[model samples]
Target: MAEPILKWAGGKRQLLDELYARFPASYGRYHEPFVGGGALFFDLEPADAAINDANPRLIGFYERVRDEPEALIERLEAFDDPDADPDPSLPYHEETARGRDVESYYYQQRARFNRRPYEGAFDPLEEAALLLYLNRTCYNGLYRENADGGFNVPAGRYANPDWVQRDRIRRASDVLAEAAIRNDDFAYVLDAADPGDLVYFDPPYEPMSATASFNEYSADGFDREDQRRLLDVASELDEAGVRVVLSNSGVMYEPYADAGFRVETEDATRAINSDPDSRDAVDEIVATNVPPEDRGSAGQRELSGF
Candidate 1:
């Protein structure tokens, strides 16, 4: 099975088992346009897949793993001493904040990540490690940034964090080797689907309440315009006979109802965030263009199991 490459803010790791139960027992090829944590991709282990994300760094990491897993592993191994302090405030922190040199910025970010309360600069590999490290250690594993694309989240309180999951990384690398990883706009992926292809989308949730919506997957946010574009894409894919399953905020269903799709609401609890008040269970939607035979089975199974 594949593991998630990044510790994403709103990853679907908890939903994978239930979601897979609803998928067609057999399908042609698997495609994940918004491949955040890739919980589903890893869990399903599809033979043919086109996994993609809008985050360039994420795509770069996956590509590197496919071509140079050992190198990435070595870098990760260097961070194994979780208690070792490496200076949290590095030069790249200021550089990234200023939108100066991104490569140098990332390197510095990694050094800070290695040292709790970071204090020095880092290299590219270390930066990647820091990214993963912060994701694992931050509040709810959420990755939020300022308008300028700098990493701005504060550290979380974890007594012990799995700084390096060597086995999981190796497994993830093996799983990714068989898939094609791409860094592109989500439409590029949706448009590439052929008939019989299965596409799973987990876009940023449309906010249910004014305070609930957050879209930091990329430096630029996915605004209402992006949502409309995604709905249009769903229409196109539905017409082409491609299986499409989506997860988003329940609030979006009212607007998306005209797209000829089915919508179901599920209860979800927030796992990443600093405030305990924001951790309560809330309603989320599962929208899909798949036929009835291919939908809702997993929901039923989950309810039955509970």
Candidate 2:
């Protein structure tokens, strides 16, 4: 199976089994409005699907991946050159080994990526390569932008951070071949999804606590109002006979349940916390349009058991 191309903050790789178990045996086209990292998308590899996100850079990257994987890989190969001179005194990856300025190259690349011309169409190849490099080398693989919509995550301290995977990119291109990728609001999925189609909503979750809140996936962070709007859209999809599934912080279960959806709690490890001690298991909910037949087994499984 093709793996996720990026290291997204709230990626669902850990919960794949639970998600698969809850999914219908088979369905029509797949729809993921909030396609961060796309762990499940790559896993399912649906022939016909509609994937979307509000992040234009991310959408552009995927579009390029679908249309020009070979070109992206060719550009990404530059990072793997062990002897490539990023500076006179050091190779890009050999800086720490040579006892020279180790982080300067990373910072320079970060600055270059941030300084990319945001006017007209974003540079697909350059932005995509920069995004791949930063996520691999940045602290905790977090993608955060400043108020001016610039990529601003600081460089991480990996002795030798892994660069792009050639094979994975080709595999992802095959999966996205028959899909319609879009950069649009999550609610706009209603236009593409027909009855019997599956739509998964992995929105920026509600904050469980003040210190634990890390919703800055974009400059326009997901707020309570966005959550409310998503709930409304999910409800409308359910009424239209579309199969809807969503993942969010456990605190936002009332509205989903009140909307007549079945909600199940699962333990998820919050791995992106700055404080290492706080990277503990937290509660997350999986809400589905159809009540799970195994509702009686909900309490049988521990929150972290998945």
Candidate 3:
């Protein structure tokens, strides 16, 4: 199986079992609008699928991964030299190591990435490489943005940061080859999905609490309105007889229960919290119209006990 290439903020690796149990045995096609780490999409490796993200750069990165895996791999390998000079003075993995400052390198690349020639001119390959590198080295593997649309996540502490995985990249390329990748609003899935297809909406979730929010994946964070819009879309899909599954914060999504979707909560391990101490497990809402017969038994079994 192909693993997720990037360590995304709301990546669903921890919730894979729960998501999997809710998946239909089979469907006409697969649709994932908020393809972050794309944990479930990559796992299913569906032949006819459409994966999308609100972030254009993220979609561009996926394009590069699919179309130029070898070139991306070559560029990513050059970044493997974490700290060559060995600044024996700094503590191990603390800010600076070897003589080179890892944090400095991260910020420098971020500046380069934000520095567009004009408004939107950029080299896709380079941006993709920088995006991947920054995500791997950033705090909590988050790709956050500032109000000015700049990549602003601070550098993380990693003794030996490894962001280059040749086999994984190649595997992902194979999986994406047959899929239609797009950069668009989540609602685009509505026009593209058919009745028998499966649509999974893992939109940026509402925060568990004030201290637990990390929704700034873009300049304008996904707020209450976006959550409501997503619910509407999911409800539409459900009514169309499309298999609909959605995941969001446990707190604000009780409204989904009123929408007639089966709303359930499961403990999901989340690491993207401002307070490191609180980055443990939290209840996450998983609403779906998938029938119990269509869903696999294992995830239901594990979640029932959980």
Reference-based lDDT, each prediction:
0.67, 0.77, 0.78
lDDT string, candidate 2, 1-306, tens digits: 677788888888777766766676556889999998888888878888999998888888898889999999887776533223354442233333223443566754555465443333346797788778777888877888776677778767677676676777899999999999999999898788999889999999998987667877777788889999999999999999888889999998888999898888999887576676987888999999755663222211212211
Candidate topping lDDT: 3
lDDT of 1: 0.67
Q: Among these predicted structures, which one has the highest TM-score?
A: 3
lDDT digits (tens) for residues 12-65 of candidate 3: 877877887788877888999999877778777888999999887889899999
Candidate 3 TM-score, true structure as reference: 0.87
Better of 2 and 3 by TM-score: 3
Candidate 2, residue 190: how far the Cα is off, in Å: 1.5
RMSD of 2: 5.7
Error of 1 at 90 (Å): 8.8
Candidate 2, pairs of clashing residues: 267-303
Q: Which ten residues in a row have the lowest lDDT in candidate 2?
A: 297-306
**TM-score for each candidate, following the candidate numbering:** 0.81, 0.86, 0.87
